[model samples]
Target: MSEQEMFLLPPERPTISHLRMFLSDLAMQYHSLATAALNGDYHTSHTPFFTANGNIVGSTRLRALIHKFNTEFSDYMRGKGEKLKLVHSRFADPLIRSPESIFSLKKKKKASQAKHAGWNGYAIP
Candidate 1:
């Protein structure tokens, strides 16, 4: 082999205990990332959350885990589905559907109390 070429063995299969510990650590790391992401959403557009090597986080793996968590959490809440009810709507985009709509006079013409407004609420015809 050339001096620039090197061979490295793959990681060994972890034992059950080691696997548990590794998963626990990974879960904690993921939790911190999610919390930081949520907290930073309300603040500046930047965040200090990065790996020790200064690499950007939130890979496909992280996104998959987030989806999994959301799914599992929703499943867990299925037993409490009876307690929730339809809540009133809230203003989202001012230029789309609000009393103080902005942007332009055309926006005022385009704005409506109709269903096409920007909202996360349940849709009804």
Candidate 2:
């Protein structure tokens, strides 16, 4: 594939199978993120292939399948791009369920700080 080439879905119409094929082809073509990024040309050339007119849409089943494949493809690319050293963390499962976890303290601190300010709402800081 040419470095600048991108797989664009038909502008007027696309099918679920088209999306699946696009993502799969994308994953195969760019298994390394550096390669994906390179093939993507830093968002100038390629964007991730799933989207309805570049937004997300479809039946529930199709959407779920697309997301699942996207995640798997991304994970696979990350694995291949060891030079980039991406880390995937499953931080919520164990910590959120455990009372001994210090995460609640951090949350409380943020909440209290939000209260101290004249704001009645919490926002990420």
lDDT of 1 by residue, 12-120 (tens): 5469987788789889877766765555441222344433234444342344457779999899888666553433457544344532333465565676645466666
List ranges where model 1 is wrong by over 4 Å.
1-13, 41-125
Residues 28-61 of candidate 2: C-alpha lDDT, one tens digit per residue: 7656544644343333333444234554532323
TM-score between model 2 and native? 0.18
Clashing pairs in 1: none
How far residue 38's Cα lies from its native spot in candidate 1, in Å, is 0.4
TM-scores of the candidates are 0.27, 0.18
Q: CA shift at 100, candidate 2, in angstroms? A: 49
